[model samples]
Every structure is written in structure tokens, then in C-alpha cells.
Target: MIPEDHFGSDAVATNRMHSAGVALEELLVTAQKQDCLTVGIYESAKLLIADPDSVVLCVLAVDNEEDVALQIHFTLLQAFCCDNGITILRVFGVRRLQRLLRGEGANRNLEEHGDFHCMLVTNPQADHCRLQEVDTYCQESRRMDQWIPELSLQER
Candidate 1:
């Protein structure tokens, strides 16, 4: 069996870079639907540690860099989510996640610098749009053991 420590290897990082774009579109859509989302590694980790039950899903944007440190960071975050029984999804590149989280028409000047590498989507209020849909999707996806995006033929 492959060892957990090997996730930081160049081979694994290269492999992850190749397949990382598959689910980005879907992840962006789901992220926009959440009204209660926490951005940045610190905020996301805090929610995961303090209130795992309230976190609906975690979407980590991995940097597709040659740096092994970045890979290790993502791996550790994924492992923590798994241990906490929280469903986590991963996509390559923090740019996509940062733009999506900024939301459409949001004032760029008012926003914090988009340096965060991960985000945690928490349970939304009842009045939020598509809250039920996202929640159901997260639960079903986790139960099915499907973490990566399953793109259709046209999406490829």
C-alpha cells in the first residue's frame, strides 16, 4: 500500500496537477451557493476543529506548484477533515477559489487579499438560496465516496 507520507512526493504532485482541473467548475458553482462560507486556512481549520458538525463541506484549492511544502499542506488538511468526519474536496490553484469566493459584483477594494488556500462551506440559513440542494449534494457525494469532480464528455 502507498504510504501517507508519500503524498508530498513529486510524482504525486505531478499526478494531482494533471487531474486537478476536472471538478473546478462544479466546485465554483457549489461554493457560490453557500451563504455561510469561511475562507482561508486559518478560518477553515478553526471551524473544522471547533464545530465539525456545522461544516457542510470543505473545498481546498491546492497550488499546482513544484513545491512539496504546498502539497504537504493540502495533504495534512485533507487528513484532518477525514479524521473529523467532514467531507473535503480538492481543486488545483487558489486563484479560481479566490475569484469564486469574491462573488459576482462584489467590490474588489473591500475584499481581503485572496491569499487563502482553502475554504470551508458551513450550513447556510434556511432562507439562503440552494442551501438544501448543496447540503444534499454534499451528503450524497460523501456517502458515495466521490470526492473528485466527475465531468461529462462535453466538459472535457
Candidate 2:
């Protein structure tokens, strides 16, 4: 039988993770509304290279681990984000992210935007609460020795 303390700790961790996921989703939505979001691998990479200082956070969504090219891009992006002092968050479920960011009618833009794998949230016009939440979560994760901590955006 498991101890009650163990169950309490597990519950705390799960709640933290859920809050972090919600924070990420809200941050993305806010960025989109403010026109401070750069989506797609090429676009995000270009923005990161051209204006690294403007990028506040980098969110990577990977649905296919078997894709060699995608892995290479993620590796390079991780290096760049680290060098630039940008927070990087890895997430699962690209489709869920797309739906969250673009809504149900976003299929038309998919062809134009390529994929929702890589996204960069740039500096917004005003301070955002969700950004702070995500930043805190990242800081805590780092303190826990989790480099490039990942969160799932999929529905529970």
C-alpha cells in the first residue's frame, strides 16, 4: 500500500502541471491577440535569428519524434534559445495547439503557415499575467533540474 504523503505529493504535482498547461495556453492566446506570436519552424527561426532580443519564450510542439529534420531544427533552436536567454518549453500535440491558437476554422491557414510545431512569443505591448505564470513555472522547473521541461496540451 502507498503512503498518504506520497498521494498528497502526487496530487500537488498534478495540480501544478495542470496550471502550467493552462498558463501556456493563455500565453499563446494572448500573444496571438497582441500580434506578438511567430508560428511555424521557419518563421520562428527567422525571427529568433533576426531579433532574438524580442523573443520572450519559445514553445515547441512535437507530434512526430521520428522526423529527422524536425529533430535537427529543434536541436538548433534549443541552442539558440539557450544562448539568447530565452525560455524554452516543449509541448505535445500540435493539433491541439493549433486549435487553441487558431480555433476550429484554422484549417485554411495551415497550408499557408506550414505547421504549428515551433512558436515564439515576442514582447507584448503590455505586461501579461499568463507570461509571468509561465516564467515562474519555467524557473521552478529549472530549479528542480529539469532542462527544457515539457508539458502536454492535450485534453484530459
Candidate 3:
């Protein structure tokens, strides 16, 4: 983490430094260790949605250390947060997740049929053009896990 004193409250910031894939992967692993099953990928979100009481925490792997696709992916997560059905966490890499999790090492609380379903996105570019609102975006994002994006937008 960068030193807090180095930043200005009024300034907008972007993470331009490209650390090896290790950092983001480490964070993912850490979050997972706390509630190991809190992560979801594939049809997992849909399955979680099926249960009225379940709270889905989504961690989207948008890169693999080559570079970070922060902005657009953040936009998508923002969209998910605005939606009632899912929660999104944008973590950078996938591999070191195990190590990071093991380092944090905590257990998750889940009922029967409860678990974290992590989808490691190795090829983010494959879905970029296909990811937008309407015919794209969540629709395509969920397809990786064999799911259809369930959008809930109705006139008030």
C-alpha cells in the first residue's frame, strides 16, 4: 500500500505502476482466507442469487500481470454494486491467490450448498468488445461461468 501522506484528498488517482501479477493475486488470496468461500465465479453468482439470504461477493480477475485494465472493469463492478443481486471485487491476478489466502488463513461461514466460486480470468481481452451494456457487459461476463446476466431495471 502507498503511504497515506503521499496522497491529496482532492486529487484523483490512478494506479499506473504495474507490479508483477503477485500483488493483486496476493490480495485475492487474503480476502479468500478470511471467508474462504466468499468469492464466487462462473454460475456461482446465479446460484448465490437463487438463495434469498446469500450475499455474493464477486472478485473479477481482469488481468494477468501483463497490464491492468482498471477503469472499465471498475465501471462494471460499479454497475454490479448498483444492482441489488451481486457484489463485486476487482482483483488483478489469479495465480498467487492461493498463497495470499493461505497467508491470511481464515474460514468462511456458509450453509449447505454454500461456497466461494472463483473464476480466474486468464483472457480478459477476449471479452472486452463483447462487454458493454445490453448485448454485452454482464451478459458476457457471466457467460464464462455458464450464466446469463440477470439485469433488474424497472420503471419506478
Best by lDDT: 2
Tell me model 2's lDDT, rounded to 2 decimals. 0.84
Sorting all predicted structures by lDDT, with the top scorer first, yields: 2, 1, 3
**Candidate 2 segments exceeding 4 Å error:** 104-112
Please say which candidate is ahead in lDDT: 1 or 3.
1
Judge candidate 3 at residue 108 and give its lDDT: 29
lDDT of each: 0.57, 0.84, 0.37
lDDT of 1 by residue, 48-109 (tens): 77888777666766556576876677678788877877666655556655555565754353
lDDT of model 1, residue 108 = 51
Query: What tens-digit string does per-residue lDDT give for candidate 3 at 34-127?
Result: 3324443434445444542343344454334343444444454446544755534344333334333434333322222222224322222232
For all candidates, the clash counts are 0, 0, 5
Candidate 3 TM-score to native: 0.33
